[model samples]
Target: MLHIEDLSYETGGRTLVDAVTLHAAPGETVGLVGPNGSGKTTLLRCVYGTLKPSAGQVRVDGTVLDGAKERARRIATVPQDGQSAFELTVREVVAMGRSPHKKFWEPDSAADRLLVDEALARVGVTDLAERPFPGLSGGERQRALVARALVQQPRLLVLDEPTNHLDIRYQLEILTLVRELGTTNLLALHDLNLAAYFCDRIHVLRTGAVVASGTPAEVLTPDLLAEVYGVRAEVAVHPATGAPTVTYLPGPRTPHATTAPASRPSAEQKTSAM
Candidate 1:
Protein backbone atom coordinates (compact mmCIF):
# COMPACT_ATOMS: atom_id res chain seq x y z
CA MET A 1 0.00 0.00 0.00
CA LEU A 2 3.08 2.23 0.29
CA HIS A 3 5.61 2.76 -2.50
CA ILE A 4 8.76 4.88 -2.39
CA GLU A 5 10.77 5.34 -5.55
CA ASP A 6 14.38 6.50 -5.82
CA LEU A 7 14.03 8.56 -2.66
CA SER A 8 16.93 10.85 -1.78
CA TYR A 9 17.34 13.46 0.94
CA GLU A 10 20.34 15.75 1.01
CA THR A 11 21.36 18.47 3.46
CA GLY A 12 24.39 20.75 3.75
CA GLY A 13 26.18 18.88 0.94
CA ARG A 14 25.59 15.55 2.71
CA THR A 15 23.26 12.94 1.33
CA LEU A 16 21.40 11.27 4.17
CA VAL A 17 19.15 9.10 1.98
CA ASP A 18 20.33 8.09 -1.49
CA ALA A 19 18.27 6.74 -4.32
CA VAL A 20 16.32 4.32 -2.10
CA THR A 21 13.23 2.48 -3.33
CA LEU A 22 10.97 0.05 -1.48
CA HIS A 23 7.33 -0.80 -0.87
CA ALA A 24 4.93 -2.32 1.64
CA ALA A 25 2.03 -4.32 0.30
CA PRO A 26 -1.39 -4.19 1.94
CA GLY A 27 -1.31 -5.93 5.35
CA GLU A 28 2.42 -6.49 5.08
CA THR A 29 5.00 -5.26 7.55
CA VAL A 30 8.11 -4.15 5.68
CA GLY A 31 11.11 -3.27 7.82
CA LEU A 32 14.06 -0.94 7.21
CA VAL A 33 17.00 -2.30 9.23
CA GLY A 34 20.33 -0.55 9.37
CA PRO A 35 22.89 1.05 11.63
CA ASN A 36 22.82 4.71 12.64
CA GLY A 37 23.44 7.24 9.83
CA SER A 38 22.46 4.66 7.22
CA GLY A 39 19.47 6.85 6.32
CA LYS A 40 16.61 4.69 7.58
CA THR A 41 15.01 7.56 9.48
CA THR A 42 15.69 9.99 6.66
CA LEU A 43 13.96 7.70 4.17
CA LEU A 44 11.04 7.26 6.55
CA ARG A 45 10.69 11.01 7.03
CA CYS A 46 10.62 11.51 3.28
CA VAL A 47 7.92 8.87 2.93
CA TYR A 48 5.75 10.19 5.79
CA GLY A 49 5.98 13.83 4.66
CA THR A 50 8.07 15.02 7.58
CA LEU A 51 10.93 15.81 5.16
CA LYS A 52 10.74 16.59 1.50
CA PRO A 53 12.98 14.43 -0.67
CA SER A 54 15.46 16.09 -3.00
CA ALA A 55 14.51 13.39 -5.52
CA GLY A 56 11.87 10.65 -5.97
CA GLN A 57 8.24 10.09 -5.08
CA VAL A 58 6.05 8.55 -2.37
CA ARG A 59 2.79 6.92 -3.40
CA VAL A 60 0.04 5.37 -1.33
CA ASP A 61 -2.56 2.91 -2.62
CA GLY A 62 -1.70 3.63 -6.25
CA THR A 63 -1.91 7.44 -6.05
CA VAL A 64 0.89 9.91 -5.27
CA LEU A 65 0.92 11.18 -1.68
CA ASP A 66 0.46 14.95 -1.51
CA GLY A 67 -0.93 17.56 0.89
CA ALA A 68 -0.81 17.32 4.68
CA LYS A 69 -4.49 16.66 5.31
CA GLU A 70 -4.85 13.83 2.80
CA ARG A 71 -1.53 12.36 3.91
CA ALA A 72 -2.71 12.35 7.53
CA ARG A 73 -5.87 10.46 6.59
CA ARG A 74 -3.95 7.75 4.72
CA ILE A 75 -0.64 7.66 6.60
CA ALA A 76 -0.09 7.86 10.34
CA THR A 77 3.41 8.13 11.79
CA VAL A 78 4.64 7.21 15.29
CA PRO A 79 7.93 9.06 15.56
CA GLN A 80 10.78 8.02 17.83
CA ASP A 81 9.94 10.87 20.20
CA GLY A 82 6.66 12.60 20.86
CA GLN A 83 6.52 16.31 21.56
CA SER A 84 4.01 19.04 22.32
CA ALA A 85 4.20 22.81 22.73
CA PHE A 86 1.31 22.70 25.20
CA GLU A 87 0.33 20.15 27.79
CA LEU A 88 -2.35 17.77 26.56
CA THR A 89 -4.02 14.83 28.24
CA VAL A 90 -3.34 11.40 26.75
CA ARG A 91 -6.93 11.13 25.57
CA GLU A 92 -6.78 14.57 24.09
CA VAL A 93 -3.56 13.70 22.30
CA VAL A 94 -5.12 10.64 20.72
CA ALA A 95 -8.26 12.56 19.89
CA MET A 96 -6.16 14.88 17.76
CA GLY A 97 -5.66 12.05 15.26
CA ARG A 98 -9.25 12.36 14.18
CA SER A 99 -8.85 16.01 13.30
CA PRO A 100 -7.88 15.19 9.72
CA HIS A 101 -11.30 13.71 9.15
CA LYS A 102 -13.14 16.70 10.51
CA LYS A 103 -13.56 20.38 9.73
CA PHE A 104 -11.09 22.85 11.26
CA TRP A 105 -13.54 24.16 13.90
CA GLU A 106 -15.38 20.88 14.43
CA PRO A 107 -15.43 19.38 17.90
CA ASP A 108 -14.86 15.73 18.71
CA SER A 109 -18.01 13.67 18.26
CA ALA A 110 -19.18 10.80 20.48
CA ALA A 111 -17.85 8.37 17.87
CA ASP A 112 -14.46 10.07 17.92
CA ARG A 113 -14.31 9.73 21.71
CA LEU A 114 -15.13 6.02 21.42
CA LEU A 115 -12.34 5.52 18.86
CA VAL A 116 -9.91 7.35 21.10
CA ASP A 117 -10.88 5.24 24.12
CA GLU A 118 -10.62 2.06 22.08
CA ALA A 119 -7.22 3.06 20.79
CA LEU A 120 -6.06 3.86 24.31
CA ALA A 121 -7.20 0.44 25.50
CA ARG A 122 -5.64 -1.28 22.54
CA VAL A 123 -2.25 0.24 23.33
CA GLY A 124 -2.71 -0.50 27.09
CA VAL A 125 -2.62 3.19 28.00
CA THR A 126 -6.21 3.47 29.18
CA ASP A 127 -5.22 4.36 32.74
CA LEU A 128 -2.99 7.18 31.46
CA ALA A 129 -5.84 8.68 29.49
CA GLU A 130 -6.23 11.51 31.98
CA ARG A 131 -2.53 12.11 32.56
CA PRO A 132 -0.34 14.80 31.01
CA PHE A 133 1.54 13.49 27.98
CA PRO A 134 4.87 15.08 28.84
CA GLY A 135 4.84 13.71 32.40
CA LEU A 136 4.69 10.07 31.32
CA SER A 137 7.70 7.79 30.99
CA GLY A 138 9.27 7.26 27.57
CA GLY A 139 7.59 3.93 27.04
CA GLU A 140 4.25 5.30 28.11
CA ARG A 141 4.66 8.19 25.73
CA GLN A 142 5.53 5.80 22.90
CA ARG A 143 2.44 3.69 23.49
CA ALA A 144 0.32 6.81 23.69
CA LEU A 145 1.68 7.91 20.36
CA VAL A 146 0.83 4.53 18.88
CA ALA A 147 -2.67 4.90 20.28
CA ARG A 148 -2.89 8.23 18.55
CA ALA A 149 -1.86 6.64 15.26
CA LEU A 150 -4.43 3.93 15.73
CA VAL A 151 -7.12 6.51 16.32
CA GLN A 152 -6.31 8.02 12.97
CA GLN A 153 -7.48 4.81 11.27
CA PRO A 154 -4.68 5.14 8.78
CA ARG A 155 -4.27 2.88 5.76
CA LEU A 156 -0.50 2.79 6.23
CA LEU A 157 1.41 3.06 9.54
CA VAL A 158 4.96 4.38 9.46
CA LEU A 159 6.72 3.76 12.77
CA ASP A 160 10.30 4.93 13.31
CA GLU A 161 11.79 2.92 16.17
CA PRO A 162 8.49 2.31 17.91
CA THR A 163 10.25 0.27 20.58
CA ASN A 164 13.02 2.78 21.26
CA HIS A 165 12.41 3.34 24.99
CA LEU A 166 10.21 0.33 25.69
CA ASP A 167 11.34 -2.55 27.88
CA ILE A 168 11.46 -6.17 26.72
CA ARG A 169 7.88 -6.91 27.75
CA TYR A 170 6.54 -3.75 26.22
CA GLN A 171 8.73 -4.28 23.20
CA LEU A 172 7.13 -7.63 22.49
CA GLU A 173 3.71 -6.27 23.31
CA ILE A 174 4.02 -3.28 21.01
CA LEU A 175 5.43 -5.23 18.07
CA THR A 176 2.86 -7.96 18.59
CA LEU A 177 0.08 -5.41 18.68
CA VAL A 178 1.38 -3.84 15.49
CA ARG A 179 1.71 -7.21 13.75
CA GLU A 180 -1.85 -8.14 14.65
CA LEU A 181 -3.20 -4.83 13.41
CA GLY A 182 -2.86 -6.19 9.82
CA THR A 183 -2.22 -2.74 8.38
CA THR A 184 0.42 -1.94 5.80
CA ASN A 185 3.33 -1.21 8.17
CA LEU A 186 6.62 0.45 7.28
CA LEU A 187 8.95 0.29 10.24
CA ALA A 188 12.49 1.54 10.83
CA LEU A 189 13.84 -0.78 13.53
CA HIS A 190 17.22 -1.16 15.22
CA ASP A 191 16.49 -4.64 16.56
CA LEU A 192 17.23 -7.17 13.85
CA ASN A 193 15.71 -9.98 15.94
CA LEU A 194 12.44 -8.12 16.38
CA ALA A 195 12.39 -7.17 12.72
CA ALA A 196 13.04 -10.78 11.72
CA TYR A 197 10.23 -12.00 13.91
CA PHE A 198 7.61 -9.41 13.00
CA CYS A 199 8.30 -8.15 9.50
CA ASP A 200 7.35 -9.99 6.34
CA ARG A 201 10.18 -8.42 4.33
CA ILE A 202 13.36 -6.63 5.33
CA HIS A 203 15.46 -3.94 3.63
CA VAL A 204 19.00 -3.27 4.76
CA LEU A 205 20.53 0.19 4.35
CA ARG A 206 24.14 1.31 4.37
CA THR A 207 25.66 4.72 3.80
CA GLY A 208 22.36 6.19 2.63
CA ALA A 209 21.59 3.39 0.19
CA VAL A 210 19.74 0.08 0.12
CA VAL A 211 22.37 -2.64 0.29
CA ALA A 212 20.01 -5.58 0.56
CA SER A 213 16.27 -6.30 0.47
CA GLY A 214 14.38 -9.59 0.87
CA THR A 215 12.72 -11.90 3.37
CA PRO A 216 14.30 -12.25 6.80
CA ALA A 217 15.92 -15.54 5.93
CA GLU A 218 17.47 -14.04 2.83
CA VAL A 219 18.71 -10.83 4.40
CA LEU A 220 19.77 -11.74 7.96
CA THR A 221 22.71 -13.93 7.12
CA PRO A 222 25.88 -13.76 9.21
CA ASP A 223 27.94 -12.32 6.36
CA LEU A 224 25.38 -9.58 5.69
CA LEU A 225 25.27 -8.78 9.42
CA ALA A 226 29.03 -8.41 9.52
CA GLU A 227 29.12 -6.43 6.30
CA VAL A 228 26.37 -3.96 7.34
CA TYR A 229 26.71 -3.84 11.15
CA GLY A 230 30.33 -4.90 11.62
CA VAL A 231 29.21 -7.55 14.04
CA ARG A 232 29.58 -11.34 14.14
CA ALA A 233 26.25 -13.11 14.45
CA GLU A 234 24.69 -16.54 14.04
CA VAL A 235 21.32 -16.62 12.32
CA ALA A 236 18.91 -19.54 12.56
CA VAL A 237 15.22 -20.24 12.32
CA HIS A 238 13.28 -20.51 15.56
CA PRO A 239 11.61 -23.85 16.17
CA ALA A 240 8.45 -22.44 17.69
CA THR A 241 7.78 -19.38 15.57
CA GLY A 242 9.52 -20.46 12.38
CA ALA A 243 11.22 -17.10 12.11
CA PRO A 244 14.90 -16.23 11.78
CA THR A 245 16.64 -15.80 15.16
CA VAL A 246 19.83 -13.81 15.49
CA THR A 247 22.50 -14.68 18.06
CA TYR A 248 25.21 -12.04 18.03
CA LEU A 249 28.78 -13.15 18.68
CA PRO A 250 31.37 -11.15 20.54
CA GLY A 251 35.06 -10.46 19.76
CA PRO A 252 36.68 -8.91 16.71
CA ARG A 253 36.53 -10.16 13.13
CA THR A 254 39.14 -12.47 11.59
CA PRO A 255 42.55 -11.00 10.70
CA HIS A 256 41.95 -11.39 6.97
CA ALA A 257 38.79 -9.30 6.96
CA THR A 258 38.17 -5.81 8.37
CA THR A 259 34.84 -4.80 9.81
CA ALA A 260 32.87 -2.15 7.96
CA PRO A 261 33.03 1.33 9.42
CA ALA A 262 29.61 2.57 10.55
CA SER A 263 28.39 5.98 9.43
CA ARG A 264 27.61 7.98 12.54
CA PRO A 265 25.28 10.95 12.24
CA SER A 266 25.14 13.75 14.78
CA ALA A 267 22.34 14.17 17.34
CA GLU A 268 20.87 17.03 15.33
CA GLN A 269 20.88 14.91 12.21
CA LYS A 270 19.09 12.11 14.02
CA THR A 271 16.48 14.48 15.43
CA SER A 272 15.82 16.11 12.08
CA ALA A 273 15.49 12.75 10.36
CA MET A 274 13.04 11.59 12.99
Candidate 2:
Protein backbone atom coordinates (compact mmCIF):
# COMPACT_ATOMS: atom_id res chain seq x y z
CA MET A 1 0.00 0.00 0.00
CA LEU A 2 1.10 3.57 -0.66
CA HIS A 3 -0.03 6.95 0.62
CA ILE A 4 0.82 10.37 -0.78
CA GLU A 5 -0.14 13.27 1.45
CA ASP A 6 -0.47 16.86 0.35
CA LEU A 7 2.40 16.49 -2.12
CA SER A 8 3.57 19.67 -3.80
CA TYR A 9 6.42 20.48 -6.14
CA GLU A 10 7.60 23.59 -7.98
CA THR A 11 10.25 24.58 -10.46
CA GLY A 12 11.20 27.87 -12.12
CA GLY A 13 8.43 29.72 -10.26
CA ARG A 14 5.75 27.41 -11.62
CA THR A 15 4.08 24.57 -9.73
CA LEU A 16 4.36 21.17 -11.32
CA VAL A 17 2.15 19.47 -8.72
CA ASP A 18 0.05 21.05 -6.02
CA ALA A 19 -1.10 19.60 -2.72
CA VAL A 20 -2.08 16.30 -4.32
CA THR A 21 -3.10 13.48 -2.03
CA LEU A 22 -4.03 9.92 -2.86
CA HIS A 23 -3.38 6.30 -1.97
CA ALA A 24 -3.25 2.82 -3.46
CA ALA A 25 -4.33 -0.10 -1.38
CA PRO A 26 -2.80 -3.51 -1.79
CA GLY A 27 -4.05 -5.39 -4.85
CA GLU A 28 -5.57 -2.25 -6.36
CA THR A 29 -4.72 -0.68 -9.70
CA VAL A 30 -5.04 3.10 -9.74
CA GLY A 31 -4.71 5.02 -12.98
CA LEU A 32 -3.46 8.60 -13.21
CA VAL A 33 -5.03 10.26 -16.26
CA GLY A 34 -4.83 13.73 -17.76
CA PRO A 35 -3.83 15.61 -20.88
CA ASN A 36 -0.29 16.75 -21.72
CA GLY A 37 1.41 19.00 -19.15
CA SER A 38 -0.95 17.87 -16.39
CA GLY A 39 1.92 17.00 -14.01
CA LYS A 40 1.26 13.25 -14.06
CA THR A 41 4.89 12.42 -14.77
CA THR A 42 6.16 14.82 -12.12
CA LEU A 43 3.86 13.24 -9.54
CA LEU A 44 5.06 9.76 -10.49
CA ARG A 45 8.72 10.82 -10.23
CA CYS A 46 8.07 12.04 -6.71
CA VAL A 47 6.48 8.71 -5.83
CA TYR A 48 9.38 6.69 -7.26
CA GLY A 49 12.00 8.72 -5.38
CA THR A 50 13.51 10.18 -8.53
CA LEU A 51 12.23 13.65 -7.64
CA LYS A 52 11.64 14.79 -4.10
CA PRO A 53 8.60 16.89 -3.46
CA SER A 54 8.99 20.43 -2.14
CA ALA A 55 6.39 19.64 0.53
CA GLY A 56 4.47 16.66 1.97
CA GLN A 57 5.52 13.03 1.99
CA VAL A 58 5.20 9.69 0.22
CA ARG A 59 4.66 6.76 2.52
CA VAL A 60 4.81 3.00 2.04
CA ASP A 61 2.78 1.09 4.62
CA GLY A 62 2.78 4.05 7.03
CA THR A 63 6.56 4.61 6.82
CA VAL A 64 7.90 7.76 5.18
CA LEU A 65 9.73 7.02 1.92
CA ASP A 66 12.46 9.67 1.89
CA GLY A 67 15.80 7.93 1.38
CA ALA A 68 14.59 4.88 3.24
CA LYS A 69 16.33 1.71 2.11
CA GLU A 70 13.50 -0.50 3.31
CA ARG A 71 11.00 1.64 1.49
CA ALA A 72 13.00 1.29 -1.71
CA ARG A 73 12.87 -2.45 -1.29
CA ARG A 74 9.08 -2.32 -1.26
CA ILE A 75 8.64 0.08 -4.19
CA ALA A 76 9.64 -0.56 -7.80
CA THR A 77 9.23 1.72 -10.80
CA VAL A 78 9.23 1.31 -14.60
CA PRO A 79 9.73 4.68 -16.23
CA GLN A 80 8.44 5.73 -19.64
CA ASP A 81 11.79 5.86 -21.34
CA GLY A 82 13.74 2.64 -20.97
CA GLN A 83 17.39 3.61 -20.87
CA SER A 84 20.35 1.36 -20.25
CA ALA A 85 23.98 2.31 -20.06
CA PHE A 86 25.34 -1.15 -20.70
CA GLU A 87 24.58 -3.81 -23.30
CA LEU A 88 23.33 -6.27 -20.73
CA THR A 89 21.38 -9.37 -21.60
CA VAL A 90 17.67 -9.25 -20.83
CA ARG A 91 18.12 -11.76 -18.04
CA GLU A 92 20.96 -9.77 -16.59
CA VAL A 93 18.92 -6.60 -16.75
CA VAL A 94 16.12 -8.24 -14.83
CA ALA A 95 18.47 -9.69 -12.26
CA MET A 96 19.44 -6.16 -11.31
CA GLY A 97 16.08 -5.80 -9.62
CA ARG A 98 17.33 -8.04 -6.92
CA SER A 99 20.10 -5.61 -6.05
CA PRO A 100 18.02 -3.96 -3.36
CA HIS A 101 17.91 -7.23 -1.48
CA LYS A 102 21.51 -8.17 -1.97
CA LYS A 103 24.71 -6.98 -0.38
CA PHE A 104 26.92 -4.68 -2.40
CA TRP A 105 29.36 -7.41 -3.40
CA GLU A 106 26.91 -10.26 -3.54
CA PRO A 107 26.73 -12.31 -6.71
CA ASP A 108 23.51 -13.53 -8.31
CA SER A 109 22.45 -16.76 -6.71
CA ALA A 110 20.36 -19.61 -8.10
CA ALA A 111 17.24 -18.08 -6.55
CA ASP A 112 17.91 -14.80 -8.26
CA ARG A 113 18.16 -16.53 -11.62
CA LEU A 114 14.83 -18.25 -10.98
CA LEU A 115 13.21 -14.96 -10.18
CA VAL A 116 14.58 -13.44 -13.39
CA ASP A 117 13.23 -16.33 -15.42
CA GLU A 118 9.84 -16.13 -13.75
CA ALA A 119 9.70 -12.41 -14.35
CA LEU A 120 10.49 -12.85 -18.02
CA ALA A 121 7.82 -15.52 -18.35
CA ARG A 122 5.30 -13.41 -16.51
CA VAL A 123 5.84 -10.56 -18.93
CA GLY A 124 5.65 -13.00 -21.87
CA VAL A 125 9.24 -12.27 -22.83
CA THR A 126 10.91 -15.48 -21.70
CA ASP A 127 12.08 -16.08 -25.27
CA LEU A 128 14.01 -12.83 -25.14
CA ALA A 129 15.83 -13.86 -22.00
CA GLU A 130 19.14 -14.35 -23.81
CA ARG A 131 18.76 -11.37 -26.13
CA PRO A 132 20.69 -8.14 -25.64
CA PHE A 133 18.50 -5.34 -24.34
CA PRO A 134 19.82 -2.79 -26.83
CA GLY A 135 18.90 -5.01 -29.76
CA LEU A 136 15.21 -5.31 -28.91
CA SER A 137 12.33 -3.25 -30.29
CA GLY A 138 10.74 -0.53 -28.19
CA GLY A 139 7.87 -2.71 -27.03
CA GLU A 140 10.19 -5.57 -26.26
CA ARG A 141 12.47 -3.22 -24.38
CA GLN A 142 9.53 -1.94 -22.36
CA ARG A 143 8.50 -5.49 -21.47
CA ALA A 144 12.07 -6.27 -20.41
CA LEU A 145 12.11 -3.18 -18.20
CA VAL A 146 8.79 -4.21 -16.69
CA ALA A 147 10.19 -7.67 -16.12
CA ARG A 148 13.04 -6.08 -14.23
CA ALA A 149 10.59 -4.26 -12.01
CA LEU A 150 8.56 -7.45 -11.54
CA VAL A 151 11.67 -9.30 -10.41
CA GLN A 152 12.03 -6.85 -7.59
CA GLN A 153 8.99 -8.50 -5.91
CA PRO A 154 7.78 -5.07 -4.95
CA ARG A 155 4.79 -4.48 -2.71
CA LEU A 156 3.89 -1.48 -4.84
CA LEU A 157 4.55 -0.98 -8.56
CA VAL A 158 4.76 2.51 -10.04
CA LEU A 159 4.67 2.77 -13.80
CA ASP A 160 4.95 5.96 -15.85
CA GLU A 161 3.26 5.30 -19.18
CA PRO A 162 4.21 1.67 -19.34
CA THR A 163 2.30 1.38 -22.57
CA ASN A 164 3.87 4.41 -24.25
CA HIS A 165 5.22 2.62 -27.32
CA LEU A 166 3.42 -0.68 -26.96
CA ASP A 167 0.87 -2.01 -29.37
CA ILE A 168 -2.64 -2.88 -28.25
CA ARG A 169 -1.86 -6.53 -27.54
CA TYR A 170 1.22 -5.82 -25.47
CA GLN A 171 -0.50 -2.99 -23.69
CA LEU A 172 -3.25 -5.28 -22.49
CA GLU A 173 -0.74 -8.01 -21.79
CA ILE A 174 1.40 -5.79 -19.57
CA LEU A 175 -1.51 -4.31 -17.66
CA THR A 176 -3.23 -7.67 -17.30
CA LEU A 177 -0.03 -9.19 -15.98
CA VAL A 178 0.25 -6.41 -13.41
CA ARG A 179 -3.34 -6.89 -12.34
CA GLU A 180 -2.84 -10.64 -11.98
CA LEU A 181 0.20 -10.04 -9.79
CA GLY A 182 -2.16 -8.21 -7.39
CA THR A 183 0.38 -5.64 -6.33
CA THR A 184 -0.70 -2.13 -5.54
CA ASN A 185 -0.09 -0.15 -8.73
CA LEU A 186 -0.07 3.55 -9.51
CA LEU A 187 0.17 3.97 -13.26
CA ALA A 188 0.18 7.11 -15.39
CA LEU A 189 -1.70 6.27 -18.57
CA HIS A 190 -2.60 8.32 -21.65
CA ASP A 191 -5.20 5.93 -22.99
CA LEU A 192 -8.54 6.65 -21.43
CA ASN A 193 -10.14 3.51 -22.79
CA LEU A 194 -7.36 1.36 -21.44
CA ALA A 195 -7.60 3.11 -18.12
CA ALA A 196 -11.36 2.56 -18.03
CA TYR A 197 -10.98 -1.12 -18.74
CA PHE A 198 -8.01 -1.96 -16.52
CA CYS A 199 -7.98 0.36 -13.56
CA ASP A 200 -10.01 -0.09 -10.37
CA ARG A 201 -9.78 3.63 -9.67
CA ILE A 202 -8.62 6.71 -11.55
CA HIS A 203 -7.24 10.11 -10.65
CA VAL A 204 -7.75 12.91 -13.12
CA LEU A 205 -5.18 15.67 -13.03
CA ARG A 206 -5.38 19.17 -14.47
CA THR A 207 -2.88 22.00 -14.29
CA GLY A 208 -0.89 20.38 -11.45
CA ALA A 209 -3.84 19.39 -9.29
CA VAL A 210 -6.10 16.38 -8.74
CA VAL A 211 -9.37 17.46 -10.26
CA ALA A 212 -11.09 14.13 -9.73
CA SER A 213 -10.43 10.79 -8.07
CA GLY A 214 -12.81 7.84 -7.88
CA THR A 215 -13.82 4.59 -9.48
CA PRO A 216 -13.50 4.67 -13.27
CA ALA A 217 -17.30 4.72 -13.52
CA GLU A 218 -17.44 7.73 -11.27
CA VAL A 219 -14.48 9.71 -12.55
CA LEU A 220 -14.86 9.25 -16.29
CA THR A 221 -18.07 11.26 -16.57
CA PRO A 222 -18.94 13.42 -19.56
CA ASP A 223 -18.87 16.60 -17.55
CA LEU A 224 -15.40 15.86 -16.16
CA LEU A 225 -14.16 14.83 -19.60
CA ALA A 226 -15.54 17.99 -21.22
CA GLU A 227 -14.16 20.33 -18.58
CA VAL A 228 -10.69 18.79 -18.24
CA TYR A 229 -10.16 17.47 -21.75
CA GLY A 230 -12.30 20.03 -23.61
CA VAL A 231 -14.23 17.32 -25.42
CA ARG A 232 -17.97 16.83 -25.34
CA ALA A 233 -18.87 13.18 -25.14
CA GLU A 234 -21.85 10.93 -24.68
CA VAL A 235 -21.20 8.71 -21.66
CA ALA A 236 -23.12 5.48 -21.52
CA VAL A 237 -22.86 2.00 -20.06
CA HIS A 238 -21.65 -0.72 -22.35
CA PRO A 239 -24.59 -2.84 -23.41
CA ALA A 240 -22.78 -6.15 -23.11
CA THR A 241 -20.40 -5.62 -20.21
CA GLY A 242 -22.00 -2.65 -18.46
CA ALA A 243 -18.78 -0.66 -18.26
CA PRO A 244 -18.83 3.07 -18.94
CA THR A 245 -18.18 3.96 -22.57
CA VAL A 246 -17.44 7.44 -23.87
CA THR A 247 -18.32 8.61 -27.37
CA TYR A 248 -17.30 12.05 -28.52
CA LEU A 249 -19.74 14.35 -30.24
CA PRO A 250 -18.64 17.12 -32.60
CA GLY A 251 -18.81 20.57 -31.10
CA PRO A 252 -21.30 23.09 -32.46
CA ARG A 253 -20.50 24.31 -35.98
CA THR A 254 -21.71 27.79 -35.15
CA PRO A 255 -22.15 29.78 -31.98
CA HIS A 256 -25.19 28.37 -30.15
CA ALA A 257 -27.41 29.74 -27.40
CA THR A 258 -25.78 29.45 -23.96
CA THR A 259 -28.95 30.04 -21.96
CA ALA A 260 -31.19 27.61 -20.07
CA PRO A 261 -34.46 26.40 -21.59
CA ALA A 262 -37.30 28.91 -21.19
CA SER A 263 -40.33 28.09 -19.04
CA ARG A 264 -43.81 28.18 -20.76
CA PRO A 265 -47.26 28.50 -19.23
CA SER A 266 -49.74 25.56 -19.54
CA ALA A 267 -52.45 28.04 -20.67
CA GLU A 268 -50.29 29.30 -23.59
CA GLN A 269 -49.77 25.72 -24.83
CA LYS A 270 -53.58 24.98 -24.58
CA THR A 271 -54.51 28.16 -26.53
CA SER A 272 -51.97 27.33 -29.25
CA ALA A 273 -53.44 23.77 -29.52
CA MET A 274 -57.05 25.16 -29.79
The residue-by-residue lDDT of candidate 1 on 1-274, one tens digit each, is 8889888999999999999989889998899999998998889888889899999999999888679999999999999999877799999999999989999989999999999989999989999999999999999999999999999999999999999899998998888788778789999999988887778789999999999998887788778888889888777656555567788878984222223212222324423432
Model 2: per-residue lDDT, tens digit, 1-274? Answer: 7899999999999999999999988888899999999999999999988888999999888988656467569998998978787889888888989999999979999999889888899888999988888888889989999999988889999999999889988997888788778799999998887787678789999999999998777787767877888877766655443445666778843222222212212323322322
* Per-candidate TM-score against the hidden true structure: 0.91, 0.89
Candidate 2 clashes between residue pairs 3 or more apart in a chain or in different chains: none
The global C-alpha lDDT for each of the candidates, from Candidate 1 onward, is 0.86, 0.83
| Over 4 Å off, model 2 | 252-274
Candidate with maximal lDDT: 1
Against the hidden true structure, what lDDT does model 1 obtain? 0.86
